[model samples]
Target: MTRIRLLTVAWLVLFPLAGLADYLEVRRETAVYKEPSKKSEKLVTVDPAERSPYLLKLASGAKTKGYYQVNLPGANEKGWIYQSYVRRYKGQHPGYVAYKRTFYKHWIDEDGDCQDTRQEVLIRDADAKVAYQDEDHCKVEASAWKDPYTGKTFTNPKDLDVDHVVPLKNAHESGAWTWSAERKKQYANYLQYEKHLLAVSASENRKKADKGPDRYMPPNAAYHCEYVRIWTKIKRDWELEMTEAEGEKVQQILENCN
Candidate 1:
């Protein structure tokens, strides 16, 4: 009877239709995330930019290499609530905001959500058919706001190319070459909907091409730290490789982030 039962288990292990049954051995030993446990392996450190609490503060307790074990707050209940909702919100900002009489609110609602805000910005731009600021600070570009690199301002998006502080080609050379098309697209379009995509002068952005943030970003005292944070977030999310200089610059920026 024992031998017959062992054979049955072996069959399930090798059968494709058995699906994850082959993983039973691991499943039996490892804990599942959904199952609550008083004992949780702690994660030593999580990237602050992507982590919750927007406090961006490190936990005062012990550190481990396991899951964070904390539930993040919902979009509407957190810091910069309107900022978060900008991703999908629809409809237009009042005409005055569009015309620059009032600054374009980064997120439509003040709740910190981003989804609806993205939809709203895009749709409104489509409806108005007016040109936004250009890289040269000339009228005619849309989506061009601040140029952190030069600490200059631009309104025309047409004269700008949303820069990759770390170039996409560099990403491909690193490990992104192994990623699926969907993930590649996500990494490629990293700044498509965020404030990261700045409208800078054509000559300046071209000069930056695939150069690391340290080499190309602006020297303006005020914007330098934020630039590093943005660059680090992109590379960390995409799991891209960094040169020594790039890493060093990121460290410097992190200091200011605190």
Candidate 2:
């Protein structure tokens, strides 16, 4: 009877503490900062090669501007650092690699239409000022080529939407859930440059809503080459995962890109 009572008491005490630990981990893990320094004034910035109290790596870089940066929330005990340093640090540390381009680049804009499409949608969406709601003027869509899931092509901007090759949910499920809001936004707005986004059929876009890259690719066997490249780039750049089938498909496509 006494042992039973003691176990019950221990459970009560430990349960809340366990819950508290979980809450703290989730809170700390998910919160992303606008700029790394803004969130924690005491946070330190370091070189990728320098041995520090934290485990950090160079995640990405911006060569156009001379700023370097590194990734935080790393696996080791040196502790967390700022996000702004991801790129510069990466350049300094040759071993610290990051993503450079996507397979979408290969999908040539024969008409050089990506920039124009993006600008038009941006302007229209900005003018309306709401996203994903009925009031919004722009939509998220796939490419103009006929979607294999459903044969349709969209020429009209109003009829198309931008689709993330790797779904945002998949990204969130991957380590992205731990990223700052700014990083999430950056990832969401990725490929703002050129044919990275497409003006595709709206119904097809809906069918692919937040689904992973493998879920809805062009069915035409010929298009798979470009399709796999885009998928691989997105997953690798964002550090997302793939089901075995998806990974194999990507491998097959990458052979072609190489």
Candidate 3:
């Protein structure tokens, strides 16, 4: 009777059609942790080779913030892994390689709404209703935005630059170089996460161009904590690597958050 019950349980875990969303295959060797945060204890490493780790996603929702609870194959262990590490398994390998800035092009109209990513960001982050030049609302003429990096406010949309918190070059050097071009485009124009992109003064954006926290921070010291926090979160979310000096500077700034 116990053997029958054990088999039933295994069947439910293996083929959870009722609650299952899909399966994700590990593309890279990544660690599953007891919690979603990297600060939490690591439970096990899920490698693409050997057993070739595949995770069964039991539900549509993440188990924790930014993590999915997955049933790891053959290990009889279940743990949370960052969603970024897993891609939906469809029998085709993604062929991930290291990111190069040349691999990516500037933002296009991904949603086909006629507005390109820059215009979309300008409209979305604007403090007031954005003024459009044409009838299609594709071209942004003006808007009010406060630049977090410089603590300066601007009324003209041309004065603001849509900045990638972790610049494309930095991302390429970190882990993004290994991602597909589609993924790189998504990262470049990511607006779903507020931390990923910002409308800042063009001068400030140029000052921070492609440099990490170690080399440059916002000129406004008052914005240091918030800037570092957003920068840290973006790097962590994307699983990007930070140099020792960059990491230390970010940590010091983060301490000021308290």
Clashes of each: 39, 17, 6
- What is the per-residue lDDT of model 2 for residues 26-107, given as tens digits with 9 covering 90 to 100? 1111222223334433233332221111122333333223322332232111123233333222112222223323412222
Report the number of the highest-lDDT candidate. 3
- Candidate 2 ranges with C-alpha deviation above 4 Å: 1-153, 192-195, 252-258
> In angstroms, how far off is 192's CA in candidate 1?
7.6
TM-score rank order: 3, 1, 2
Note the Cα lDDT for every prediction shown. Answer: 0.38, 0.39, 0.67
Model 3: residue 11 alpha-carbon error in angstroms: 36
Report how far off residue 182 is in candidate 1 (Å).
2.4
User: What TM-score, computed on C-alpha atoms, does each candidate reach?
Assistant: 0.44, 0.42, 0.65
Model 1 spans with C-alpha error above 4 angstroms: 1-144, 191-193, 256-258
Best by TM-score: 3
Q: Residue 121 deviation, candidate 1, in Å?
A: 8.9
lDDT of 3: 0.67
